[model samples]
Target: MLTLNVVNKELCVGDIRIVGVSSASIFLIGDTEVVSLSSMFDTPPESVIIAPFVPLPTEE
Candidate 1:
């Protein structure tokens, strides 16, 4: 299993056996064995502005 945390400011992710990572927007897991997983989670608050990277195509 793999643990992961996605939140503002920083992201922390780790596992029980031999996998750990901290303070990153993206986590990379490459061919490893693990036992358990855990994570500190958070929810997005209201009034937070989020912009889409790809804009939708508009009809003429």
Candidate 2:
């Protein structure tokens, strides 16, 4: 059981920049009660691979 007596207020944002938000990422900017996050990678042991570093192609 949970209870929240939230108050009222004003929020302002100016000139804000976010670089990156990966998988299972949450970006909150206000009141919140409960937040649950989970990240799972279900892969067999033999399915993993290690290879050379190859950058992703980008537009010119």
Candidate 3:
């Protein structure tokens, strides 16, 4: 399992079943879940992509 401390308040945890490291991005699979974390070659990412398969409930 791989864990990343993101922004000090949030944590990005995933089991590294496999890693496809390219010159562009790093792909990971955790507990039947797949995610991609990438850094732009020219620009930085303003937002990260969260997999829809992982759900977070909204509060009303």
- Please tell me which predicted candidate would have the highest TM-score against the true structure: 2
As a whole number from 0 to 100, the lDDT of residue 60 in candidate 2 is 57
- Once superposed on the true structure, which residue ranges of model 3 sit more than 4 Å away at CA? 1-7, 24-60
- Give the lowest summed-lDDT range of ten residues in model 1: 16-25
The per-model lDDT (C-alpha) reads 0.46, 0.63, 0.45
Q: Against the true structure, candidate 1 has what lDDT?
A: 0.46
Q: For each candidate, what TM-score against the reference?
A: 0.18, 0.43, 0.18
Residue-wise C-alpha lDDT for candidate 1, range 1-60, written one tens digit per residue:
456654445546575332333333344444334434555547556655545343434545
In candidate 2, stretches whose alpha carbon ends up further than 4 angstroms from where it belongs are: 1-10, 45-60
Q: When superposed on Cα atoms, how far off is each prediction in RMSD?
A: 16.2, 6.5, 14.2
lDDT of 3: 0.45
Per-prediction tally of clashes: 0, 0, 0
TM-score of 2: 0.43
**Per-residue lDDT value at 40 in model 3:** 43
